[model samples]
Target: MSFEHVFKRIIEFMHADPCGNFRLMVGTDSQVHKRHTVFITGIVIQNEGKGVWACIKKVVVPRKMTQLHERISLELSLTEEIVGLFTEERKNELIEIVLPNLYKGATFTMEGHIDIGAGKRNKTSEFVKEMVTRMESMGVEPKIKPNAFVASSYANRYTK
Candidate 1:
C-alpha cells in the first residue's frame, strides 16, 4: 500500500482509542536464496494490550546477499526508509492524538527494531552499536534481539 494509505490507517487506529498506550514499530529482516534475497519490513502499531494494526513492505534484491554485515545493514536501511516516510509532521499528528490523554497514562513511542543480537554467540553482535546509533540518530528507540520481535519474528516470517 501507499504511504498515505498506511498513515491514514495508523491515524484511524489511534483515533479509535486515543487514551490507550501506543507503540509504532518498524523492523526489517531478510532471507537469501540462490538467486536473490528477499527483504520484508514490518510496520506495526500496537495499542498496548488493546489491539494492533500492522503491515509489511517487501523488497527483492537481484543478487543473493551472503555477507553478514551487508545484509544486516541493508535490513536496517530498509527499515529506516520506511521510518523516514513518517515525517515530523506525520509523527506529531500521531502524538497529538494521545497528547490530551497523557495525564491519564496514555503514551506513544516510536521504535526501530534491528535484527541483531548482542550475544557472544551471535555474529550480528559486532554491528549492534552501529545500528543502534543510527536508530537513535533518527529519534527512535532501538530494540535488538529478544526484544526486537518485529524484526526477528514478524518480518523474519515473511522473508521465508
Candidate 2:
C-alpha cells in the first residue's frame, strides 16, 4: 500500500529464496491536483538472470483490474512460468557460461549481489580468495583497499 511497505515485501521475497524467482509489488508516487496523490503499482524482478541464469522467460502486467480474482490467477500463472524456465539443463548451461567468464573479468562486477561496502564476511573472504587465485593464474596482482579508506582518500583530495 505504501512505498516502504512495498519495499519491505520485495526484500522479504528476495530473502525467502535467494535462488528462486518471486514476485513483489512496486509503485511510484506522484501528486495530481495539489493533494490528490496516486501511486502506480508495477513489478520488478530481483536477482534476474543471476546465478545459473534460470529466471522468468517473460512477464506480463495487466493494466486493468477487471476482476477481483484475476490478480491472484495472474500471479500464480506467472510463478509457474518462471519455475518452468529454470530447468536443470538451463541451469547447467548457465553455470558453464558464467564460471569461465568469472576468470576472464568479463562478468566479475557484472554479476554478484555485493554492495560497494556491505556484505557478509564470508562472501568477502571468498571473493578475495577467488580474485587472488584468478589473478595469480593470469600473472597479475590484485589491488585491495577498504571501501571507507578509498572514499575518505578521495574526499580529502576535494577538501584540499
How does each model score on TM-score? 0.99, 0.24
lDDT tens digits, residues 31-130, model 2?
Answer: 1223222222123333435422111122334244343234323432333333333345543443344354444432211111111122455333434454
Best by lDDT: 1
Question: How does model 1 fare in lDDT?
Answer: 0.97
Error of 1 at 77 (Å): 0.5
Error of 1 at 83 (Å): 0.9
Q: Which candidate is the best by TM-score?
A: 1
Which regions of candidate 1 deviate over 4 angstroms? none
Give the clashing residue pairs of candidate 1, or none.
none
For model 1 the local lDDT of residue 83 reads 93
Residue-wise lDDT of candidate 1 within 1-160, one digit each (tens)? 8999999999999999999999999999999999999999999999999989999999999998999899999999999999999899999999999999999999999999999999999999999999999999999999999999999999999998
lDDT of 2 at 114: 12
Over 4 Å off in model 2, which ranges? 1-70, 105-160
